[model samples]
Target: MSMIGLVDCNSFYVSCERVFQPRLCGVPVGVMSNNDGCVIALSNELKALGIKMGTPAFTLQPLVRSGQIHLLSSNYELYGDMSQRVQAVLEEFSPTVEPYSIDEMFVRFDGFAHAPLLEHARQLHHKVRRFTGIPVCVGVAPTRTLAKLANRAAKKIPAYQGVCILHAGSAETRNLLQKTELGDVWGVGRRLVERLALMGIKSAWDLAQANPKEIRRRFSVTLERTAQELRGVPCIEMIDLDEARQRIMTSRSFGKLTDDLDEIREATRQYGQRSAEKLRRQNGLAKAVLVFLKTNPHRQDLSQYSPSLVLELPRPTADSREILHAAGLALERIYRKGYLYQKGGVMLLDLIGADRQQLSLLDTPQSDAERQRSQKLMDVMDTLNRRMGRDTVKLGMPTPGAAWHLRCAHRSDRSTTRWDELPKVRAL
Candidate 1:
């Protein structure tokens, strides 16, 4: 009677772009990396045209020039907004929904004995497509692992129209497991695939039928759980509460290489601000920050320089000012004035929820009232930024012409939120 549903967006980033521009339908469109560097997402048409992910733009420039592929810069803002909308819609369908990733969610569908699971999934798909213009594939199974395999099959088979249901002990379910590639199964990464292949577990069905004891002895509990999940046993449960992030890192490749201390400071400050924003959004504080600078790894003829500095904060704080100050100090220690630096990032570690913080008596401490007031102010700032456009109230750290601002040539405006930069859709 246990059931789980995996809802996956089809080529999510490209699909989101196509939704806004209907003309892009049936075309080979792709979304690029931070600096329009490489292909990160590809449409079905582009995939069929032999375009692959992470192929540098320069390498694919010939194909791009031939008009065989359409490209767009990564628009995370639009994609994030759409992802939230999809999550909101999915929440209405089930009491317990887990957002698995940016474009996938798993929902527990118990206590609905009479409800037709496929029909329900179909309705959900149609509603999301109609409202957001984003297509999705839904997989229903007794276990989460099988549900993921079913979703993959759903995308390949046109008859299902992006919906696959794997009932327990069904022939269709067996066929699905057989057809799925061993490498495609969840938890079966490249290294595990090679190891499993050596053991003659070459297919998903094989792995599913392997002895659990052997898997546990040879591998670990993680792979053992995967095997059990494949056999229609639910090992992973729906996570109602978001899990704590083990690490938070904000990194980017600069538009150009430069080692000027002022430019380095500007970039480090931007990275720190970004890291701080993530900390605030997650309602967590950072205990330490790591700042790193590296020159182009490819340029070996020139002496390559890469160094990082880690600094522990006096008090764990989510304040941008405090984090940036620490990051700037770290950067000053690591930055080499002569070498051109191509990339830099800030990593925040030892994160814990704001409410569950363990205060230190020996450390410089703020009173409970003062701490509450500071948190409230930050909450207000975040809320205002979300309701209005980002950076409406500027933080001096992210000032314009800061050396690390993304080189967005065709950037879209915050049309929905910004009054002055509203998008104009032409009517035929």
Candidate 2:
């Protein structure tokens, strides 16, 4: 019988960091979020230090000063490259590989006997680690949901040795489900877990045993599908991972709260450029741009003003110039002078396929040549940015000491991607 296998990287970001700086492997290492505001990824050693995900970096200053914990700014470029390398290795193992997330992939295992399937999973796990220097756990089961559960088991159970296979009616599968909490299940959230607890479904096994009809009656079809999935039925379909998003948003918190409109405008313009890049990457166009600003909500003593405005484009376009113009107009309308802004963002709304653009007779006709020129310009800009680093060719010069600049003091080198930053071997 065909089975699904989930290959999940263990402590993906931390592992990526360790691949370059092996010293970070045994240390309590953490990858901070944008602006180094909070911890987003942690190594197993860091988790043992009693620091949870999303713990503010400021609170961990004592640990850092004491040399008990190490925090590094998120190196997204490095992580993205590492993820691609792992995916390339995974493609060698299975023909049909579906990336569930950056750190997880679901691959189909067809026409393999039980023993061979398990052996193949073990080999795939070893090969990924050997080729990419990133450790991964493989979980095989009849359904994706079960495969997810099996993957969790592979991570948690020492006996599994990083590879687990679970058949639907197997005693091992039932024991694993019973041991798993409802909240730990793939589709079950905190709210759903609370609701399930009240319904006497405190574990994955309980949910698996619940009546599917009753689950639908009390909750949504989604929950019912989850219940069915828990019972080894595959209700979820793996859609195209490369599908265009309905909307694109790019935003970041300022390094420091600022009331300067120019600083905010610079940040907004950059965000608009990023949103337009994302829109074009998916071969889509936006009809409008939304600009939003927020004051620091944590400071209740200070007056707060959050404002947002949306400006529609003359016509749907992915041109950064048009998007940035709309974003500027929207920002001017929404920006408050007296309030210190903590964050600002641009959202590309009402996205449509670039090929499906509707022509408007009322608007001045943009000649085909003009449209081609615009596209070619955008293509060139994107290519240069991707080949080089971001902001290598920017629309406008960013002001020095811009408040919107990210605070990443502990960032590591982009050793893999940048030639100048590659690791050097010193003769001792």
Candidate 3:
């Protein structure tokens, strides 16, 4: 049987926290976003307490003061390291592993027909948890869409034991499809759900039974493929690890409001630098830089302004300084005074492989020597930063007293990543 498995980490951000602070395993916890502005991740206990995702951190002050809930700041480095460990363990279980996100992966079980899939999935789940200290749910099905439904069931239902399998064309699988709501399907958004509702297709089973030909005509070929996949006909294939990104962006809200144009410019430069670093790491060059500035929308008495500008480069380059220069120019043009700026960032767009770059007739490309020299410098800088710490070597990004640095007031140690911050065991 041809089956695919999706391993989804359970409350991934929260789980990463619990790995070091084992006491937090059963505690109600919420992970706040940049500047501790809003809740982005929650533990099961937090969800049970009716603390909805994206709730502003300020509003939860009363709960925190009463000692009813625990809060942790977003620690991307730790979470990112944990994700790699989990992915590494998962790679040992399947022939092909496709990363869906930071906390989700799809595995292709093409030729492993004789072995029981559910048992294999269970073993894989245990191995990941045992090795990485992260809990996960596995969903197994013949198609990715149905596998998504099984994953949902694995997480939502009580009896699945973190592994849910829906055999192709089985009555149990049909019942599961019938049980799933139309809006809950992966690709079905509110607009699509409304349209599907008008056509009496109110559930996954309804969509599965709909005419694929008519769906392709009335809606889109994408929706048709989804419907086909829901009925166990695979449409989407596994994406390769080196899949190119459409865009790269880095943004963050400030710890406090500011009216200074230079401060906002500096923050935009920071974001642009990071975005460019990612571009170069991926071996992609961008033709445009996008800058955006915004003020707090919540403050009714204050003047609110949100402006964005796109700067097209004369020559596409992955050089951080070049990207920041364009981003700074764009920022200077769109930035407005008087309004208190709360956030700013940069985006890289119109990206293409740097190796296969095309030069414009109006301008000449950089000499091979210069390009090689720049690449070597960037490599050395990146190496130092990774070996020492973030910003161990910098290219003009402000180190101390920087507003772009997040408000991680409740951050935990980088136990696994940083040797200086590793947890010490107590001899009992």
Candidate 4:
């Protein structure tokens, strides 16, 4: 039986903030989304206070005014830097650590059936806490779905002490499944829940004992695989780091609604820079560029327009300038007056590796010297930015004030990334 362990950071963004300012420990806190618009993360205290995720920040301003709750803007630079530290600690414990998300990872067992897996998990938790100061829950089981259950239980139940292990095909695993709700099971959505409830499959154990062929006929093969995994059978494979994505997109909602085309153009340039960077990192080039703009549909009084366009490139390339130019033209074709656009983005589509593409018939061929120079220039820019910091080097993207930029008014100091922001110390 294959044993899989999942480690999940608790309220990741909130935990990242508490790491440096120990004063925030046990305090009610929330991390807002782009534009500091909504609460995207909540600490335990905030959760106990009935403050739910995605609640508008304006609605919670009363709590902040009363000093009962505090809010932090989404400081991705700080959060991402902290995530790297946590991953470094995880790598020490497992050679097969698969990062499922920024705050979650799966560790597949190599040969640890004979070892004290539960004890090992406890030790891993300590090391991570000491190194990164982020609390995590660890769950070990025969499959990924069961591990997810165990992880949830570890976090919710005080008895688990942040680590829970369920042996493959063990009696404890079955009992745990009986207690787990169908809604809580991995891959079970609201639609699946309603269908499963009608079939009298209220819990994971019920689904595990259901007829697999019937489930497949009624639903999807994916659900059938979930039932098998619930029965201590391996179904979901670990994700590959280099897996090709269907499309690459980078976008964010603005701080406030705006109809200005210049500001929208600047947003596209920023997103284009990011998308092209990701394309180059993946060793792929895109044959088409996509641009999308969305306006607030909730306001019935105001004219709302959400338009998207796709334009094929003259030549497929991962060059940021080329992608931005294509995106600009697409925006020009689709942009309309009189609508307050709230969000925009750029997408790189129809990706293929550079070595695999055939040039367009109308494309002007690049000279070998010109191609070499372009490649060298991009390499140098990427290197400098990596060495200094993100976007330390720019490609015509606005560096100064832009009205469409995300608002992080209450952002914490990026102590780890900035010199002046670093914590000060004085001799007593």
Best by lDDT: 2
Clashes of each: 0, 0, 0, 0
Q: Put down candidate 2 lDDT per residue, 360-379, tens digits, no spaces.
A: 66545556667789999999
Against the true structure, what is each candidate's TM-score?
0.90, 0.93, 0.90, 0.93
lDDT by residue for model 3 over 216-256, one digit each (tens)? Answer: 99999999999999999989876666978979999888878
* Residues 330-411, model 1: lDDT tens digits: 9878877679888899999888788888877754545666667767777777787778877665456444665566766645
Error of 1 at 72 (Å): 0.9
Residue-wise C-alpha lDDT for candidate 4, range 305-407, written one tens digit per residue: 8999999987777878889999999999999988899899999999998778785565454554555676677788788777777787877757355778889
Q: Regarding lDDT, does 1 or 3 come out ahead? A: 3
- Name the runs in model 3 displaced over 4 angstroms: 238-241, 304-314, 329-337, 358-366, 397-399, 425-428
Model 3 residue 62 CA deviation (Å) reads 2.3
Q: Which 10-residue window of candidate 3 scores lowest in summed lDDT?
A: 359-368
In order, candidate lDDTs are 0.82, 0.91, 0.87, 0.87
The alpha-carbon root-mean-square deviation between model 2 and the true structure, to one decimal in Å, is 2.1
Error of 3 at 240 (Å): 5.1
Which residue pairs clash within candidate 4? Answer: none
Question: What is the alpha-carbon lDDT for the whole of candidate 2?
Answer: 0.91
